[model samples]
Target chain A: MATKTLIEAIREAMDEELENDPRVFITGEDVGPRGGVFRATMGLIEKHGPERVVDSPLAELSIIAIGIGAAMADLRPICEIQFADFIHPAMNQIMNEAAKMYYRSNGTWTVPMTIRAPYGGGISGGLYHSQSLEALFAHCPGLKIVIPSTPYDAKGLLKSAIRDPNPVLFFEAKKGYRAIKGEVPDGDYTVPIGPVNVRRAGDDVTIYAYGMMAHYAVEAANMVAEQDGIAAEVVDVRTILPVDREGILESFKKTGKALIIYEDNLTMGYGAEVAAILSDEGFEYMDGPIRRLAGPDVPSVPYSHPVQEAFMPSPKKIADAIREIAEY
Target chain B: MADQSVDLQANAASEQARPSDSLSPEILLEMYWYMLLSRRLDERAWILHRQGRIPFHISGMGHEACQVAAAFAINRGVDYVHPYYRDLAMCLAVGMSAEEFMLGLFGKAEDPSSGGRQMPSHFSHRKLNILSMSSPVATQVPQAAGLAFGIKYRIAQQLQDPEDETQPRLALTSLGEGSTSQGEWHEGMNWAGVHKLPFICLVENNIYAISVPMHQQMAVPNVADRAAGYGVEGIVVDGNDILASYDAMVRARDRAYSGEGPTLVEAKTYRPVPHSSDDDDRSYRSRDEVEEWKRKDPIARFQQYLLDRGILDQNKIDEYEARAKQMVNQSQSYADEAPYPEIAPSLDPSSVYAPVDK
Candidate 1:
């Protein structure tokens, strides 16, 4: 196993898929010879040529529409929106077209495409560049939403998402592109797209999260365990939609205390669903009230470093929340 | 034709209907047959709506000539069609059975389009390469560009890729003149023009987009005038003339398969009927205007043209009417008997995105 960064893991998964299946191709604003603004698709155009790695116009609506049509025509398309915040223009294509194609067509037609967009705030990428859009898509039933925390999970889960029969919205935490590193097995292996990854095992309180927030939750769990001996469980909810209900309940059952975290705003954020699920199904097992720690509903992460830092949940915030849940 | 043709578009209106060298009598009759079938279906739907059997009905009564002609001129199975709701004639020409249309109208389990999911006239036939439709206007326009792009891509990657190999493919996407105002429509057309994908767009301008007239939709007198902006050639055709519409689409298809890029064919016509069963056109337009357009009906003009060419007599015309009526009657019976989909009373996991729940 070799240690790779999160973005490197994503590129590796795409490289393998494009090599394995010629039907697979990538298209976005700068995903071609330019190698994408984030460089997540770097070296891919050199390996796969221009046709397999297409450069689309700046129109986000058409980008997703092309994916839908190509997918319908028996091609596996990985359409990247340059940034997470830029997906709004393509929302109709995503929500009405890609998301509902299968169900609307009554399973006769399926959109086997993946939409990749780098999301979240930590890199001083103010309003437009740093926003989380998972909650908005989580409400859509036909779409599979996957956001991985670690390099290993990013590689495996992305591969799984690409191969999934339905359309999957793969949101990469831009903050962890190079910062997060983990040992990823060489060659062929896929982490399935329906379960939670238990990063740390504990017996006191459970912390559930996804994307970059999940990475911070594990760190907070370790911090609480070392200093306060809070014994907190940390579960990375890699797949957001059709969430790992059984896995979530199992993790909550161990600790009997739940604290959900996310980088998106708190109002109806994805974590609220987890808290609701815990309250609904894990009620009898709960030893304390479920807690949610998320960004304040301020539209977006501001440009100022302190404000952006304040917007996102850090290790200290998660540790404090975990400690409070354990005490409760 | 227009007195002075625009720079970006070629005018396709013929002053009189001539016996076309391009179409044989058999092909013309086939086109007429489909047109009549679609009209009969549309009329029957209105009747059903009036009878309280169905909730909604949208008629393509006056748009049939261009619809059938454009469909007949194209390579049906090889080309893809992203049709708007008022494309009944086009769907029939592409091999969708009449009963299937009825099944869709009734939203029965046997409906091939959406299996009781979508409303009537939302045409879709998988085997014929007709893509499924959504209610949103102009959304399929971009999808059409994508289909053309996919075809171009697969052919370019023929050796390495395993997509079907008929090198040339044309994606024919059509919408009412109203849909051109949508942002997605521009996005779709721009993509087609930029890539020079094998694509053709048909904008059936029926004068009025429901209650709103053509003048309110855009500032330009013609939708074809917008073609230069997208770097594609546009054509204005007399949609009521079957021969002219056929010629426009045929020429557009030739340009696409030859790698000349996309062509926008704006077919000028009129919608005699109300927008749908839900609306009243009388509130907006006068009865005199409706009656005036009915005189220029495509079916009647085409029938008269065929008679002038000695293609058929009154006896043959009666027979065609009998055939269309019989098909529609049988389809209505079949759809009425078709079963409702077997969805559970509550939320069915299988219908939604639980395919990966395991």
Candidate 2:
């Protein structure tokens, strides 16, 4: 095992896949000599050359479209979007073409491609640079959404996403790129697409989160455990679409309380979906109402530090919400 | 009206000097047959839609010559096709049977494309290498580029040999004139040109995008002009002239195979009918204009050519028409009696993620 950052893990995943399979290639903006905007693909071009590590033009539609075609042509293409917020231009291709290729063709065709985007807000990236679009893409059937919180999950889930037969939207938390480091396995390993990882086992309340928010949830759980003696179980939902429903319910059943924390807007966020699932199955086991601590319904993410802080769900806010749920 | 006839005669004269002169009389006759079959099938589909038997119908009446010619130019089952909605002739020419078209029209379980999941005109046949189409226009353009990139990459890496007859594959994608205005179209064409990928972007300029006319869609006189900006060759042909289209497509395919990158071929034609069952061209276009275009109907012009060449007489034309009609009728009846697909439950939860080995 080696200690690595989330971005390092991602690069390693792509490097390993490119080495393992002849069909595997990386394509996106600045993914070649520049090594991506976030330096996630640094030194890949030097190792794999331009054909394998393609530096594409600034067009998200073609980026995903080429990935679809390459995937259909029996090439495993890993397409990177500079930021998740910039992915809207390619939404039609992703939703209509990539997501529906398998079912629409009656299994005659499959788009085995992975679209990686750095998502969420913590870097004061303003509106256009920071956005969490997991809920929107997760609503699209035939697509698997994998959000990794740590370097370990980032590496493992990305490998699995590259190998999956269907299209996968692998959202890497930009906030946790270098901020969150963990010991990842040295060699080949894959965390399955859909499974909830119980980070800290507790019995008082279940704290559900993914991506960068998972770390905050653990921090909040720690705070609650020290201050209020409320043992909170931190459940890192690795996959958002085909959610770890059984594991979530099991945690909720054990804790008798649930609090969903996310960076997306509160209205119809992934938290709402988790809350609905718990409401349907774990309603009888609930001690109080299922709560959600998420971003407000603002038009765009704020640019200012103070305003952005207010916009985001910080650990203090999550801890306070967890304490309130623990008391309830 | 006099000027239009002069242009048609000039187009016919130019065809004599084109590469189509090398085509055998038998091949020319076969081209005419597919074009005629597409027109008849389109007419039947419109009638069925009017009778409320089908939900929708997109006619390929005026576009048959170009679609068939392009299909004939490419290697079937080898080159990937990203066909648009009005590609009945293209699909038929690529070996999609009348039964499959009828099954798709009726949304029957036996439909080869989507098993009734997709609407009619969203053509897909796995054996023919036709990519499934979506309602969103111009989305397939980029996909075609990507497919071409895959083919080029495989050949260059020696993963697949170019010397192999079927090794060097090209991608052919069709779209309406109005679709050229879409950003995806430009992006896709640009990517193909940048990568020097083997791709052909065929724009069937039928003069109308539903109610909107082509003049209102773009300022450019021809859709192929946009190809210049992408650093690719652009060519225009009389879409109503079968031999002209055939020559253009043959040249385009050859250029692509020789690693000359993509070619944007604009086939200038007119939609003889309303865009689809839901559209009414009479509201936007004049009846007089439609009549004038009908006078230059591709099928009639091809029939005239066949008679002039002594390849087909009136008797042969009648026989071919009769066969096409019989095939359409039999397929319609078969599809009408076909059952809807039975919805089945998923036996494995991870089927979508992991391919279950058969």
Candidate 3:
């Protein structure tokens, strides 16, 4: 097992996939010689020529639209939206075109393309730069949303997402790009797209999360255990699209007290869906009220330090929520 | 007389569909047949809508000549076509059967496009290389550019010349003049021009976007003029004239294949009927205006052209019309008998994403 930062592992996955498949190519603003705004695709152009590693213009709509077209042309394209906040311009291309291509064409056409957007609030990017839009895209049924919290899941899930037969939205945690480091094997191993991993097993409550929040949930579990001796289970929900329903239910049924954590606005956030699913089918197994710790319903994540901190869900905040839910 | 004959030869060479020589008289008639068939199918669709057999209908009344001509000029099967809703003629020419069109119009179980998922006139068929259209206008333009870029990139990867006779094919996308105002459309054109991708964007300027007239849509009088913004060649032609449309499409196709990059073609036409069955032209437009454009109809103009050239007479024209009517009738019967789609599959969340659930 080799230790790699989240960004390095993502670059390794793209490099390996690009080398293995001639059909795989990447297009985005500043993705070529500039590598990427985040340096996720650094040196890919030199390794695979300019034709494969294209530097697209600063137009998000066409960036995703062209990827859909290229995929229809039998070439697998991975289009980067630069940042999650910038992906709003491409919602039509993602939800309308790529997501529905196969169903609209009655299984005749399929868009085997992956859209990468760096999401979550961190780095003091203010309102425009730092945002979590996975909840927005998660509502789109035909799309598979993947958020990786660790370097291992980032590389493995990214590779799997690139090879998916349909459109997959892969959102990386901007806060965890370099901050999140984990051991990753140096080969062709891939974590399947639709399973959640239990980072820490417990008996009191199930803490569900993804992306940067998943790491926070793990930390909170450790904190609650060390301080209050609360054995909390941390479930890293890697793929939220066709949610690992069975795994989530099994984990929830095991620990009836559920605590869902996400960085998006709490009302109707992705965490809400988890609450609904629990209430819908897993109602009888409930022991405590389903609690959610997420961003407040603020219009934007402010640039001011205090406001930004208050807007973001931290490990301590998650630990407090876990403690409350466990006590209940 | 000799000078006049030479001028006629030049006109024929410049305007007619290509075969290294002028199109054979039979081939000209065949093109006319597709136009007539498209018109008949469109007429039947409107009647079905009126009769309550279908939910809605969008007519390609004045667009048949340009649509079919463009398809005929390109290698239909090999080249991808991202067509707008009003492209029945193009779909027919590019290899979709009349029954298939009717099935889609009726939204039947066997409808190849979506299996009744989408509304009528939203054409899509994979084997024919017809890109599936979404409701949002001009969204297909960027995808069309991307498809062309993919083809050219593959050619570049193989180290082959895109200018060669048949190595890399281009993508042909059509939209209404109203869609030209969309940002995605501009983004697509700019991308195509920047990459010098083999792409052709066709604007069927039918004067209205539903009810909003072209004057309100954009400042430019001609949609082709916008091509200058993207550094691409632009051409305006009378869409009612099949020969002119085919000639322009052929020239654009040649320019793209020769690596001259993309082209913007504005075919000035009219939508004689309302935008769709749901629209009402009487509210905004005058009957005289509708009648005026109807005289410049693509099908009637092409029919007259064929008759003047001795390619068709009253008898042949009648025969073609009869065949088209019979084909439409038969298609209607088949669709009428076809069953509606099963609601379960569409509702099932499993098939929503490919490769089934993980």
Candidate 4:
């Protein structure tokens, strides 16, 4: 195992997949010699030749739509949409073709393609560059949604997505790319698409988070454990679409209280879906109503530090939600 | 280079396969049959939809000849196809089972294309290598290029010997006229052209897009002319003429397979029906324009051409129509009997996202 940043882990996964499978390839703007804007595909083109590491035209729909076509021809293509903010141009392809290929064709043509986008805001990426659009893809039925918090999970989950016979929207949190680091294995490893993992086991209040919010949840859980004398069980849902309802329900049962934390807007955010699912499915096991700590319902992610802090779900807010739920 | 010339010769031979000589006598009859069948299926689906039997219906009425001819000439199973929603004839000609089409129309559990997940008109089949059609138009164009590139890659894998047979080529994808307005279409065509990728861009131009006509949608005279900007051959084919469509597609496929890059075929046709059962074309289009296109009816022209060539007698043409009518009836019956997907099935997301065993 080697200690690596989230970006490095993603690069390692791409390198490994390129080496392991001739059919596997990476295509997007600056993916070739430039090695990607975030360098997630660094040194891949040199190692695997230009054919495997294609530099696609600067068009989002072409980048994504072509990836779907490539998958239909049986090439496992992983596409990078420079930034999640720019994905609006290619939203039709992702929401329609890539997502629905399998179910649309009744399993005839499965597009084993992965679309990796740098998502979420924390470092003030402005309005266009930072947005947690997981809910957009999560709303689509056939598409598998994945958002990893750590480097290890990023690498493994990316590998699984590359090989999986279904279309996957692999959202890599930009803030977590270097902010989070862990020892990732050198050899081939795959993290299963679905299931919530226990981040820090506790019994008091269950905090469900994913992507960058997972880190904030951990900090909140730790702070609550020390200051509030409340144990917050944090569950990082790696795969957002096929959410591990059982694991989340089990956590909710153990804690008897639940809090969903996300960086996306509170209104119609993925948190709403989770909150609804828990309330509807595990209402009997709940002590109080499931509380949600989400980014305020706003059009743009704020640039001002104070305004941004208010827009995003902070550890303090999450901890307060945990405390409120625990006391209730 | 020699292989290209030889393929061109074979194309010439296929064009002159029988004594009648014209494409109408050779392949136009079959093309017409598929078009009528597809149209009939669309009609039946619209009726079922009105009766509250099916939820939705998108008709591919007037663009049949171009779609069917392209589908007929392509090597099924070997060649890949990325078809847009308006390619029902293409799907049928490529061997999409009537049962699958109807199941898809009815949004049934047994629908091989969408398993009741997608609405009607979104067709896909595995055996034919046809990528599933999506509701979002123009998105499939780029995907078709990628699929064609993959076919080349796969063919490369099979060519163990340096002096072995030339790489097997795959036909690219088809799209609508309005889709040309999307940037992906230009991007995809340009990329495929620059790379000399084996792909054909068949633009199924059925005049209007909902209420918007070609004049309002594009500045250029024809979408095909835009291909020259990307260094690919562009041809303006009479989409309504089955023989012309067949000739155009056959050439496009040959040019693509022979490493001559891509071809942009603008099939100029008309949409007889509305965009969907929900649309009212009379509100947007003129009666005079509709009448003009009706005079150029693809099925009638091809059928008449065949009769004039003595390749198809009146009895044979009637027989084919009767057979197509019977097939449509059978498909509608099958669709009626088909069951809707159980709402409870969605509770288990495993069916949708099951892991592929490595």
Candidate 5:
């Protein structure tokens, strides 16, 4: 095993897949020469050649549409959307075309394609770059959404997503690309798409989070344990759509209190769905109402660092919510 | 004054350009048969829609000649097609049976396209390499380009063996004139042109997008004129003339296979009927205009060509029409008696999103 950043892990996963399968190729703006905007694909073009690592035009709709078309022709395409904020322009292709290809064709055809996008706040990317739109994508059926919190999970889940029979939306947490580093296995490995990982096991309360918020949830859980003598369990909900329902329920059954955290807005974010899931299935095991620590309902992510920090769910905010639920 | 005279002369030249007789008698006869069959099926579908037997109906009306001609020119079962809604003739020519069309029209379980999931005219048959279409207009343009890219890449890598054919496989995508206004169309065309991919873009210029007229929708007089900006060959054909459209498609396909890049073929046609059963042509168009277009009906024009060439007698025409009508009748009855599929337990929302073991 070797220590690596989340971005390095992603690059390694694509590199391995490209070398393993001839049908696998990467395509997006600047994915060929410049090695992507964040350098996630730095050295892929030289290693795999320009045919596999394509540099597409500045058109998101065509980028994803071409990927769907190529996938239909039996090629495994890994499409990068540059940023999660730019994915909206290609929503029709992703939600309507790619997602519905298998179901609409009655399983006669499938789009085994993966779309990766950097998402979340904390780097002050402002409105255009810092946005968590997982809720909009998770609402779509026939599409799996994967959000990894660490380098290990990032590489494993991305590899599995590229190999999945169905289309997958792999959202890489921009905040954790370099900041969150861990030991990733040297050889091939894949984390299953729809399973939860317990970052910190405890009994007093269950803190559900994923992506960038998973790190904060663990920090909050640790803080609550040392300061307030409360044992908080942090459950990283890896895959958003086909959520780890059993894992969440099992964790809730032991803790009897749930605190959901996310960087997206609270109105209809993924946390709301988690809250609903708990209320519907784990009500009998709950000791009090499910508490949520999430970004407020704002029009857009602010540009200023202080405003952006305030807009996201920090560890202090999560710990306070956890403490309130633990005491209740 | 000189430019006006030149324009008038060009119009006169186009009017004098008749359907080419280069195609063999057998091919011309088959084109006539498919055109007649498409018209008969469309007429029956509209009747069924009016009788409340079907929920919706979209007519291909005056575009049958172009559709059948283009389909005939392409390599079926090898090349890919991303056809639009008004491609009944194209689908039929590409090996979709009349029974399949009827099943789709009735939204029956036996429908090959979507099995009662999508509306009729959204053609998709895996065996024929026909791509599935969505309701969103012009969304298939970029997809066709991508498919062409895949075909080119595979052929280069020797992943797909060319089946005894000299020319490489290409992708054919069709759309209406109004759909050209969509940004996806431009993006797709630009990409194909830049890559010089084996792709063909066919625009069935019927002069209307639902209720919007062509003049109000586009700044150019002809949709093919836009191809110059993309650095691809553009040609205009008489959509009412099967031979003309067939010849144009043959040239376009050859150019694509020869590594000359993509081509845009604009077939100037008209929509004789309303866009759909729910639309009323009288609101946006004049009855006289529709009646005038009926005089140049593609099926009638092709019949005249056959008669003039002495390839088909009046009795033969009657027999062919009867055969087409009988086929449509049998298919409609079969689809009407077909049962709907039983709802599967897995279709439930609770089970659909349930976590599965890895």
Candidate 6:
């Protein structure tokens, strides 16, 4: 096992996939020589050469549409959107083409491609550079959604996504690129896309989360264990599309309470979907109604430290929701 | 009418026929029949749209010859095709069954193209190497170029292997005269032409893009002429003439296969109906222009040429029309009997919809 940063793990995944599959390739703006905006594709152009690691023109639509065509032609293309916020311009390609191509043709055509976007806030990158748009894609079918909280999950889930026979939207939190570090296997390995992992075991209440929010959930779980006498079991849904329903249900059965958290707008966020699923599948297993702790629904992330702190779901918010669920 | 026009043009070619050319009379007849089936299917779709049986339809009426001829000249399954929404004729000419085309229009579970997911007229068949058609115009151009590049890459792999029979040439994509206005069209063409990729850009210039006429779309006068900027040769053909479409497509295919580079064939034609079922062409186009085009109908000219040459008897014409009508009727019945997609099954696979673990 090698201790690697999120960026290094991402680069390793690309390198390994490029070496393993001839059909696998990487393409995006500044992805070839510039090594991507986040430098996640650093050394790939030198290692794999330019043909496999292509730097496309500034046409986002073309970049995505070409990737789809390439995937349809049996090439596994890993595309990057310079920033998560820029994905709105290519929504038609993702929603209409990538997400619908498989079921639209009744499995006749499957787009085995991965779209990597650097998401989440905390770098003071402001509006366009740091938004989490996974929920927008999570709403669409015929697409697999993978979000990694650790370097191990990042590398393994990415490999799984690259080989998966469906379009996978791989969301990498920009905040965790260098900040997060974990031991990743040096040899080839893959983490299945549809299962949730219990980051910390407990029986008081369930703190369900993913991406940057997963870290906050774990932090809150530790704080609650130390101070509040409540043991919060945090479940990280690594993959959002084929969400680990078994993991969620098992956690709920143990704790009999749930507090879903995310970094997007509070209304209609990823947590809402989880809440609905638990309600439909495990209503009797719950001690209290599922409560979601999500970011405020404001457009601005605010420049001031206090307002910025108030924008996203904090550890306090997760703990408060956990307390509400546990007490109920 | 496009079929009739091509037959007339082919008859005009009999005196110049060379014995060395492998394109025989039987092959020409087959090409003509494909065009006829496409035309009949297109006409039925228009009528169905008019009668409210289907929501909308786009007719490939005047562009039948170019589409059908190009389809026959290319390799099926081995080659890739990124067709525009209006290339139903090309899809049928390539190898799509009439039943499949009808099922797509009906948007039924039995529709092999989309299984009722896509809108009517969006054809997709993996077996035929036809990419799923998107409603966004000109989006397929770059995709076609990339797909052709991939085919060439695969062909290089095959050539390295001892037992592979893949030739590596992929029949690329085609779009409308107005679609050339899109940046993707130019980007795709430029890439294909610069690399001398095995790609072909067939421009179905039907003179109008909904309310906007050809003059409004581009100031360059012809879409084929834009090929010079892309570093490729261009050919202009009468899209209404089946024989001329065949000649242009055959040459384009040969040029691509021989590694001479991509060819831009601008087939000049006109739309015989509104853009879609909801469109009112009369609001924008004059009746005089429509009548003039009606006189130059391809089917009428081709049928007359066939009758004059004694290749198709009067009884054969009746039989062909009857067969076409029966096929369309059968397709409609099949779609009607087919079931709708289950709502529960449409949930996200990674989340709510996965089957419970055993």
Misplaced by over 4 Å in model 2 are: B1-17, B344-358
Clashing pairs for model 1 are: none
Model 1, B154-251: lDDT tens per residue?
77877323234342278999999999999998998999999998889999998787888888888888998999999999888888888888878887
Q: What is the C-alpha lDDT of each candidate?
A: 0.87, 0.88, 0.88, 0.79, 0.86, 0.78
Candidate 5 lands at a TM-score of 0.95
> A116-170, model 3: which lDDT tens digit per residue?
9999896799998888888888888889999999999999999999999889999
Per-residue accuracy of model 3 over B37-151 as CA lDDT, tens digit each:
9988998899889999899998888889889889988888668899989999999998999999999998998887778889988998877888899889999999999999888
Give the poorly placed runs of model 6, Cα more than 4 Å off: A300-307, A316-328, B1-22, B48-56, B156-168, B180-196, B225-234, B302-358
Docking class of 1: medium
Scoring only the A-chain of each prediction against the true A-chain gives TM-scores of 0.99, 0.99, 0.99, 0.97, 0.99, 0.96
Question: Candidate 1's error at B345, in angstroms?
Answer: 8.8
Better of 2 and 4 by DockQ: 2
Q: Candidate 4, residue A282: CA error in Å?
A: 3.9
Say which prediction, candidate 1 or candidate 2, comes out ahead on TM-score. Answer: 2
TM-score of chain B of 3: 0.92
RMSD of 2: 2.3
Angstrom error of the Cα, residue A301, model 4: value is 2.6
Model 2 sits at an interface RMSD, in angstroms, of 1.8
Summarize candidate 2's per-residue lDDT along A90-187 as a digit string, tens digits: 99999999998888887788999999999999798999888999988988878999999989989999998999889999998998899989998887
Native-referenced Cα lDDT, model 5: 0.86
- Over 4 Å off, model 5: B1-22, B162-168, B349-358
True-structure RMSD for candidate 4:
5.3
Q: What TM-score against the true fold does each predicted structure earn? A: 0.96, 0.96, 0.96, 0.87, 0.95, 0.88
Q: Tens digit of lDDT per residue, candidate 6, span B167-285?
A: 33665688888888987787778767755777888998888888788888887667877899888778777777766667777777777777788888887788878888778999988
| Candidate topping lDDT | 2
Candidate 3, residue B89: how far the Cα is off, in Å: 0.5
For B178-219, candidate 5 gives per-residue lDDT tens digits of 999998899899889988988999999988899898888778
The CAPRI quality class of candidate 3 comes to: medium
